[model samples]
Target: MPEPARDPRLKSLINQLQPGPVRKVKVIGFDGVDVLVQLMDAEGEEAEIGRIPLYEASMRRMDNPSELFELGQEISAEEIGRWREGQLHLSARACEIPALRSFLLSIERRQIVTGTVSEVHNFGVFVHLDGEPDGLCTGFIRVPDLTWTRMNHPSEVVAPGHRITAEVIIAETRSGQVTLSLKALREDPLIRFADQIGRVLTGPITKIIPFGVFVQLAPGVEGFLHLSELTDEPGETSDRLVDEGELITVRVAEVDLQRHRVRLCAADGEGGF
Candidate 1:
């Protein structure tokens, strides 16, 4: 019979160190993807035990471990898990810090918070707040809230390390989410566009569907050109007349402020092309 896989002696020693902030660790080397460091005793003066691994070492994906850590540099991390077969893990994300979490939760809804953009994705932007909770970015700005303009991406409005002020939309302490909105700081462009009712507007066909075509009347403002209104022919699909990116003129039939929609119809002899 084969002997049972034995737990290393280091497991017991690591079990004694509770999961949280690791107070004293001197970065010694990098094992390809992880930062190898030595844990020091409480006095912060003497080496306590064997070397431990700081996995990933950052919340954001990094190409090189050296970008995050250097030799002989002292740093702190939240101990997340113990070694199973010699694999200790730590997390360096800003959201995992206790003081940072507390400060984020205390922020009131609709209150403006100042932060520097840490990362920008197609979906949203992450912000690292200033003042007491520095370095820990717990806030997020979704794509729609990034701007009043209808942009294809968030990078158009903000970039990494860009200073921004956003209104807190929600503060969920348990999940460590502080949702923010940059558009909340500005007036809605739709309100101004609403004044153009009954006027002829021309724009390239942005999207086409079986029911209707969508025309960009203005930036962030679109009007639906229903099939029934596209041509004199009663039973026709919208695509029969206009293709996408073809400029056409349409009259704004109605502006539904409650629904925030603009209904449009082809202007005299201007349905297609």
Candidate 2:
């Protein structure tokens, strides 16, 4: 699926999107993963039909739409856009909490937001953003967005109650989340090393994998040395040739700034026999 943030359709929606005067709809039936509803006017009279896709049904996970709504149940939903079928696509999640949709709509890309860390999970960190409606924790930082350097866990960078400032990646009303990035505020450590390609440097092996080993040339800067470069002899495994923390000399073969990766080869004077 195309990322909503990068989708041109979504961009156009964001530019003109406004919150509220939420629509009132009455559940009519279910069509597979979609919940069919009848749009209601001020008089509560039924008008045209609308749809709430499974993903837009709720902010919380549910196996089926019936779990949240019943036949003839009246609910509030925001009209996001019309589906390809010509029926209006609505977001029940956006209207779940009052003012949440408005708060998310207020955030723009690259805008800095401040928040306090609420939870640190292996996958990401949840934050309670400042100025958000009470009881709403809308900020989130994925593991890669936490920092530029390698880390075993998010706790190494932030803990609960720690105040932090981050750039907004996206404000998703469908998910009721504001994707944030702390590393976006910091300079990439690999930028300085981009000019050092082809220079021979000695560093301890930081990690060894089945296909290659990683060498740390500087703080937070590491390069990959493929197993083939570790030995001229075929069939030699990486771990058999180098141990973790063992210092080895390697020449920078390539620096990929876009991907944040470095390629290394055996030093000119040193042959892996």
Pick the lDDT winner.
2
* Residue pairs of candidate 2 with colliding backbone atoms: none
Q: Ten consecutive residues with minimal summed lDDT in candidate 2?
A: 1-10
State how far residue 239 of model 2 sits from its true place (Å): 1.2
lDDT of 1: 0.71
Model 1, range 53-100, lDDT digits (tens) per residue? 433355546676688777888766555566756555555443335686
State every prediction's TM-score relative to the real structure.
0.56, 0.82
RMSD of each: 14.5, 5.2
By summed lDDT, the worst window of 10 consecutive residues in model 1 runs over 1-10
Question: What overall lDDT, based on C-alpha atoms, would model 2 receive against the true structure?
Answer: 0.86
Mind giving the per-residue lDDT tens digits that candidate 2 earns over 11-119? 5765544444479999999999889999998898889999999988998789999998999999999888776778898989888876987799899889999999999
Q: Residue 188 CA error for candidate 1 (Å)? A: 0.7
Number of backbone collisions per candidate, in order? 0, 0
